[model samples]
Target chain A: MNFVEKKILEEGRVEGEDILKVDSFLNHQIDVEFLNEIGKRFKELFKDQKVDKILTVEASGIAIACICAQYFNVPVVFAKKMDSKNLDKETYESEVYSFTKAKHYTIKISKRYLGRGENVLFIDDFLANGRAALGIKNIVDQAGANLVGIGIVIEKGFQEGRAILDDLGINLHSLAIIEKMEKGKISFKSL
Target chain B: MNFVEKKILEEGRVEGEDILKVDSFLNHQIDVEFLNEIGKRFKELFKDQKVDKILTVEASGIAIACICAQYFNVPVVFAKKMDSKNLDKETYESEVYSFTKAKHYTIKISKRYLGRGENVLFIDDFLANGRAALGIKNIVDQAGANLVGIGIVIEKGFQEGRAILDDLGINLHSLAIIEKMEKGKISFKSL
Candidate 1:
């Protein structure tokens, strides 16, 4: 097993039939050193791609994207999940359905940040249904920017997220992929 | 003038009479190298304090907190602005009123992450009315954690945030304090 898989096995918790809570390290309580290692892994994984900027959705995605941007030596632009008075009037927006929240919301990126023909790498903490990735891809398309690749810290391989992205020919690299979760036990895909 | 003040003058925009937008480099589009500089500056300012964990509100604060946590060699625990299904039931929550969003919301941190007597340093991008900082302080107190200091990237000096924090005897450090913003011009506190 790799470092991320080892961390997941050691620290990850199984919440429900579907929920795997890794909040202790990945999302809620961030381990900077571990995230740095994850960033380095991602850099090595996508070493060939030209990443002009790293893009992600707000809240959970911000930390990983910022840390990963250091490896790429590029700026990071995050899509805001809610409307705010401070955001610019002109923006590129996409509709996203969140299974966790059980609702659909708009994610926006300001026009001032994303430039045409720029290469963007979308990074996030989880890949569940791939709806959020599609949402980010739509916004990248709207901005006329290139969506070079998508980097995920964890992927639910049992779900249809990977299949959806694969159909679209998206270059995806996930550190750990959980193939099954049953009776509070987790197993990983042995790719 | 410091690096933050210089960058604010060059890229920040004054909206109406109050809002100062530094989206070009700070919030919306993050400059990772610039954030490293910010992280270094914050580390130098709070070198004396014992920071076990860095705390902040979610979304905007996550990037700055994560980047700053690298300098301190600690973990970052951000309070979630919205309730997630994945968040634990046992949490330390505080109610905060948002001036920009014009609503009240609850910020929560899991009881599992923050321990009693842990020394935490709060970090954020902007310190306006200080409601967010106050809310974070309340959570820290509820957890019996020591809030040693607050590190702000920019402080709205004309606002009441600093005074409010000062009344509580909070040790606050701001890289740049905008004393005045009028007619698209910003002046920093002399310090």
Candidate 2:
């Protein structure tokens, strides 16, 4: 978490008061080595939880989730945002509203992937409004899978995402939490 | 490669004549351990090539590329198919025609991630019509990067993807090439 916070401060570019652009190392151009460390940290945090699968949404979350899946030694199932002809008709779907894009998109996973009584760990790149978090939780619930844990690489602690997940009694772990981001300045939630 | 082949034979489902669904391992629900074998094999195949980066498209390709990036000890940059508020406006964009979905979409990558003279290796889950391959190649060309090689997990030999990539004089390596898929029966091209 120290390294991640340091990396964010050193390389993260703040746009306006909300956006943290970490495309250089975290999202677009992935630093696999750094993610491996994050993955290790997630594994350490949830060592007691039996994670059968790592669930996430496509695009940004895929890299973080896949990297973490290595540490969990489990399969990663990312909910598809795009409509693929090959995706099964029988799916557990959830809608997530993107505040940035100002649009709602459906995230779906084949029902066959998640089984009853399976423990699924939700992993993602960022948690802000908790829309994606809630959407993934919806799918996990539909499949009757136990939501073992939620691992986030970065969390905007100022946002309501944490409170929402906590209200659902979801055990959530975030590597880096930005307590404040204003006027090109960012503050972290101290341990 | 044997394990990959066995995985395809076991978990891969053929829908209609063109689609081979390997979502269980390759795409949707990723088998991390099995993909690690693929990562190693890709490294072995391109051992002589000095790969500076592993380039791929979003979603499905991210997992394999990220896993493979470990063996190459390089970063992986995936082209974003969807627009995002966080994505830099200055991007190298390409149009890819999705034959499966019957639509065209633009894939973009921030200009900062790719450099002018870096050696890049393109990795993906499947290669069929070669639109995605050509689209990615276009981005690499725009970045003025050298594409050292293109490694595909599965190639539909009956399609034009291989021909298109080969026409570009690209050094292509496919772990498995399906020679034919008819009546739900699939045949592979013997290496």
Candidate 3:
């Protein structure tokens, strides 16, 4: 297991049944030192790629994407998952279904930020069902930008998220993959 | 004007009537290089204060706070504006009224992140009405944390934000202050 996986196993909490809340460190209260480490790791992983900009959904993904973008020396654009009058005119959008919120919303990105042939990196806190990832990919497709890689902090390996994303021929790089979390015991994928 | 302020004037759009749409570079789509510059400038401004953590409202403030935290070698804790099942308990909250959206929402920060007497620095993209800044200040107060300084990228000086925040005896530091926006022309507060 990598440093991230080890940290996840140590700090991550398995709530109720399916939810793995890293709110203590990852999402709710950010550990900038750890995120900087994640950023360095992402740089090592995608060192060869020419990443011009980073893209992510709003709220949780912004910090991770921004941190990773600093390593790539690229701008980070977060997809706003709400309808805005300023964002309504010129935008690339994709519908996303949130299991946690139990609602669906269209994530929108301004055309000014993304362009044709620009190498884009998608970063997020979690990868559960791949719905949000695919939704961002949809926007990248509409913008005619190249989806170089998706840098995720945590991936739920037991789910079909990876299978669906892999089918899209996108390069996936997750720091830690949780194989299973049962009875408050977490198992990680061997690196 | 500083680099951030200059960039804002060059690319920011005066959307509709009052909303300054810096979505091209600030909030929606982030310029990481510029944000790094912002972090440096914030460090310079708050060099005297021992900032333990950076705080801000989520979705928009996460990037700025995270980037700035690197300079202080501290963590960034963003308050969630939305109600979450996971975030409903053991959190410090403050109500904010949005002038643009004409809505009110509570911003919550986990008690685990903030603690008593911890020096906190508040960072955000804009300070129009000071609702968000004050909301965060409320949380800082509730947590018994010291409000080191509120670092804002752009402040709409024409509004009542600064006046109200000044009455609270909070030290406010803004990179750029917009005196007014008339007919797409911009004016800044003379440094």
Candidate 4:
């Protein structure tokens, strides 16, 4: 197993059946050192690609993207989750449905940050239904920016997210892919 | 003027009367390298404090806190702005009144991350009205953690945030203090 998979096995908690909570290290309480290793791994995976900027949704994705940006030496542009008055007037927005929240919300990026023909690599903490990634891809399309690839820290392989992104022909690299999760047990997909 | 002050004049925008938008580098689109400088400055400001962990609120604060956490070599625990089923059941929550949203919301941090007598250094992008900072302070207090101090990238000197934090006897440091911001003009407080 790779480093991320090992970390998952060590720190991740499986709640019920669908949830593999890595909040201890990846999300809630961030382990900067471990995230740096994850960033290095991502850089190694996508080193050949011409990356201009890193894109992600707010909150969870911000930490990983910012840390990962150091290796690429690029700016990180995060799509805001809320409809705030503070956001720019001219923005590229997409509708995203959150299963956790049980509602659809709008995610936006200021037009000034993303320009036409720019290369964007979408990064996030987890990939489940791929709705959030698709929403980000929509924003990238609106800006006429190229969605070069996506880098995910963890992927729920049991879900259809991977297949959908595969159908779209987008390059995706996940550090850890959990194929099975149950109460008191978790298993990762083999390379 | 400091580096932050200079960057503010170069990149920050003044919208209407009260808003100074630093979206280009500070918020919407993040400049990772610039944030490294910010992290360095924050370290210099609070180098004496025994900070066990860095704490901040979600969304906007995550990026800055994550980047800043590197300088301190500590884990960052951010309070979730929205309530979700994904979060831990046992949490320390604080109610914050948002002037922009014009409503009250609860911010929560899991009980697992913070502990009694743990030294916490609160870091964020902006300090306005002190509502968010106060909310985080409430969480820190509930956890029985020692709030060593607060480090902010920018402080609205005209706002009551500084006064409120000062009244609570919290050690607060803001890199750039905007004393006045009118349409087509901006001024910083002389250090």
**DockQ of each two-chain model:** 0.91, 0.91, 0.78, 0.87
lDDT (0-100) at residue A131 of candidate 3? 95
Model 4 misplaced stretches (Cα beyond 4 Å): none
Residue B65 in candidate 1, Cα distance off native in Å: 0.6
Model 2's TM-score against the true structure: 0.98
Task: Please give, for residues B110-168, the per-residue lDDT of candidate 4 as tens digits.
Answer: 99999999999999999989999999999999989999999999999998999999999
Score each candidate by Cα lDDT: 0.93, 0.92, 0.87, 0.92
Q: Once superposed on the true structure, which residue ranges of model 1 sit more than 4 Å away at CA?
A: none
Candidate 3 lDDT over residue span B64-141, tens digit each = 999888899988888998667777378888889988778888888878889999999999988999999888888898
Instruction: Go through the candidates in order and give the clash count of each.
Output: 0, 0, 0, 0
Determine which window of 10 residues in candidate 2 chain B has minimal summed lDDT: B1-10
Best by lDDT: 1
lDDT of 2 by residue, B81-162 (tens): 8777789989999999999889999999999999899999999999999999899889999999999999999999999998
Task: Give the per-residue lDDT digits (tens) of candidate 1, residues A1-191.
Answer: 99999999899999878899999898999998999998999999999999999999988999999999999999999999977789999999989999988999999999999989999999999999999999999999998999999999999998889999999999999999999999988899975
lDDT score at residue A42, model 2, on the 0-100 scale: 94
DockQ of 3: 0.78
lDDT of 4 by residue, A1-191 (tens): 89899999999988887878888998899999999998898899899899999999988999999999999999999999876789988999999998867899999999999999999999999999999999999999999999999999999999988998999999999998888887668888985
- Chain B: TM-scores of all predictions: 0.98, 0.98, 0.96, 0.98
Residue A156, candidate 1: C-alpha displacement in angstroms:
0.2
| Candidate 1 TM-score over all chains jointly | 0.99
Per-residue error for A118 in candidate 2, Å, reads 0.6
After superposing candidate 3 on the true structure, give the runs of residues whose Cα lies further than 4 Å from its correct spot. none
**RMSD of each candidate?**
0.9, 1.1, 1.4, 0.9
What is the lDDT, from 0 to 100, of the residue A102 in candidate 2?
Answer: 93
